[model samples]
Target: MAQAGTAKQPNILFITVDQMRFDCLSIAGHPIVETPNLDELARTGVRFDRAYTATPSCIPARAAIFTGQSPAHHGRTGYEDCVPWRYEETMPGELAKAGYHTQCVGKMHVYPARSLLGFHNVVMHDGYLHHNRMRHNVAAKDHFDQVDDYLVWLRQQVPSADLVDLGLDCNASTVARPWELPERLHPTNWVVSESIDFLRRRDPSKPFFLWMSFVRPHPPFDPPQAFLDLYKDAEIPEPPVGDWAMQEDPMQLGLNPVTDKGLVPKRRLKQAMAAYYALITHLDHQIGRFLQVLNEYGEMNNTIIIFTSDHGEMLGDHHMFRKAVPYEGSARIPFILNDPGNRLGLKRGAVRNEVIELRDIMPTVLDAAGARIPDAVDGRSILELARAGSASPDRQQDASLDSAVQGWRPHLHGEHAYGHLSNHWLTNGKEKYIWFSQTGQEQYFNLEKDPLELHNAVNDAEYADCIVHWRQQLIEELKAREEGYSDGEQLIAGIAPRSTLSFLKA
Candidate 1:
């Protein structure tokens, strides 16, 4: 690895996907999905077994990734569109300042539709954002032609084509279908296509920071026919339905495609799962294509590749279909860091159990580039932990690394402002404690024993003390907040959720 002040810097390839569950990858011991390329990436580097998105949604999760700050610091605790992205320090901005040429290929999801945040240039395509697509009271600048680069290119290829032409609602619907257009024109393929183009056109004088963000496996569960066919005859497992989530009445089982929770028909659910897995497989293949191109450019060995998702999809886990819930299916994300040159002397294929989150990405990127992490940033680099394996006694000889590991928070506090489902949770990766703000309902899970969160052990005597400990930690975490969620003595429920906090709005 280049030293902090060295002239040569490593290239950063930051890849992000939308609403992909942590268990979707084959490397993660998933039963159905096959992700050979991702598996290879994990084997060549480190895969974090317990990584999470502090704010489990697109807008806020990405906010943490770019700013290296927690949800409280960033002031976006939930999913909301049209909020302006105003931050002085960002991962790309810091990298650009350190002389890295920065570029983003897909899905900025920032407001005004064209806000670059920090990249030198962005090829933007935030798929099916209702705020941008609204016909009424929409500005010309927010129009598709004005903001979406992929839409413009698609129009040139097929005059009448649009993202929603396949008749699937981006967020609300889980209906699955094969891509109607050629596989090359699919948005997933376009991301890689544009990224490869950037590699070809980039100036060779400076190292580059490229963000390849894919807006798939989110919804509209459409994979190309070839990818979809991979799961056509396969036996798909039913989504885990916790006793706590069981609905006695069949009528209560959601019939609407837009429902966020409630059981759907078995056949329909299976189809959705098949399509979702297919999309992941399709993305894996495209990533493989991009890796081949990067190697061809001779940049693969010298570059740092970090693959993660903004958040996870519920995929009917505990009868929840979307994100913003505090469950593992929605909050946990897949995080794999590949340093092909072994620049940091990291333990290859090591699976670290330390609880990490999206906030850590910025610091990690800056650390790899030998750039200065801003004082305002709240996240710490995981490089030391990667170097020493875990903070276990044998690996604590290095005083600095030991101090860093000891200072690591015992638990991560995560929340999302999703109205009735709005919740705050605390976890150290092995166990989780969740408190729903609206109802004050509590849930406790021993993730080591029940990875799928199939059983809620809140009322069990075995975990009572553990629950109390986590609850107090959450109180300390929220007491200083403007929302009055915690009064220092106890939690105060029934506070109306705010997607963007007061400071952010100002």
Candidate 2:
């Protein structure tokens, strides 16, 4: 007989979908995509509509999630075009030590994409897919242009020369679909297959922490024939602010390079959005299969299932096709948590509007699994929200938690190091402030009325006090991080370069 007090330790099924935006799901109210599995998952779990990625790119966002630290502190500034070889503390490292069988499959985007970080097993997958250093030549780069190892394996199935016409395109193609070509393989399918294989052979005695990541609905918009056909008659909604010519923001004005149509005409926007949604629907179908396997093995009831994306794809929103902007379309990411224990007595189907970030995920997972959370994990766990009705349960802490000054932090900060120098943001409650170092431009928005953030109130004299407060928040936050460093600690943490450390110490 199971003791009532002996807490049931739930297995964690952590799935990360690359570049999936917040509004891409059918349940999230996307007008085009048919995401049945994601919809179902949303129905049974908490949907964090306002969850933001601390950094909205590949390597930096991933490092933040794994290590539970802000990118400013992690030192993975941006997508550096190479593998990050640094051994940093990771969530799986704590879980693995605590006896969970940790495994990672698919695109982690962490340099190498093969770093164990903390996972006991890692099935290395795609790293740099969209980037091409070569100038285009008349000869089309054949089947294996990106993700070299994957293309090499595809060649073993058929002669490389035979699959030459099926060359991979890193950029989304409006002219053609690569499916008819023989060597093209969907990265999402490869991730799902790897996950299924691992689950098939997983030991039943020990619980598991599986980080199943998929790279799709990311770009190159190459969804298979079946999924594309499924959305043939579907109506894709025109975004509320699709026309860039009418926009006032300089960021919006400067993003003319993202569109496949060069200038985004309304008709082309609809077609492109439909194609992106089709890829999302296809990704959802694969997730459905993975979930089905868990259910068949009776692991569903004992698993703490989490589904989220690293960041978001603009999909032509704000006239930008890809991410790396401070707009809500690129900054906000989807976050969902479905713990079976919540099914019995805890609150299920909850929606949290409170602001959170990607860094919070590491501590949250560790809290649920009863794993040791390293002191280095700066983000606080949201397990309190599941264990108790509120994120902060005690009367004293709950008061503050429910009020804006609670739970692991009173305010959160974000930074984007690549692109135009950098953009740093800080927000608490309904007030948000952004600062771009390159342009020395500052913007402020009261999210209460201006959720879309169309109007910039930075120059307004009336809101000067509010701007000052948020600016202080950002400065104080950065200063706090700076204070955490010491001569000895900085050297051991590898924060100071070898040459600089020696000179400074001397």
Top-lDDT candidate index: 1
178-200, model 1: which lDDT tens digit per residue?
Answer: 89999999999999999999999
TM-score of each model, paired residue for residue: 0.96, 0.81
Off by over 4 Å in 1: 1-7, 138-141, 249-253, 390-404
Q: How far is candidate 1 from the true structure (C-alpha RMSD, Å)?
A: 2.2
Model 2, which residues run further than 4 Å from truth? 1-8, 130-153, 158-178, 181-185, 242-262, 341-345, 387-405, 479-506
Please give, for residues 316-407, the per-residue lDDT of candidate 2 as tens digits.
Answer: 55445566566677778888888665633334665566677888899888877777778887787765554333342232333333433245
Best by TM-score: 1
Clashes of 2: 1
Model 1, residue 477: displacement in angstroms?
A: 0.8
Looking at model 2, the pairs that clash are: 84-111
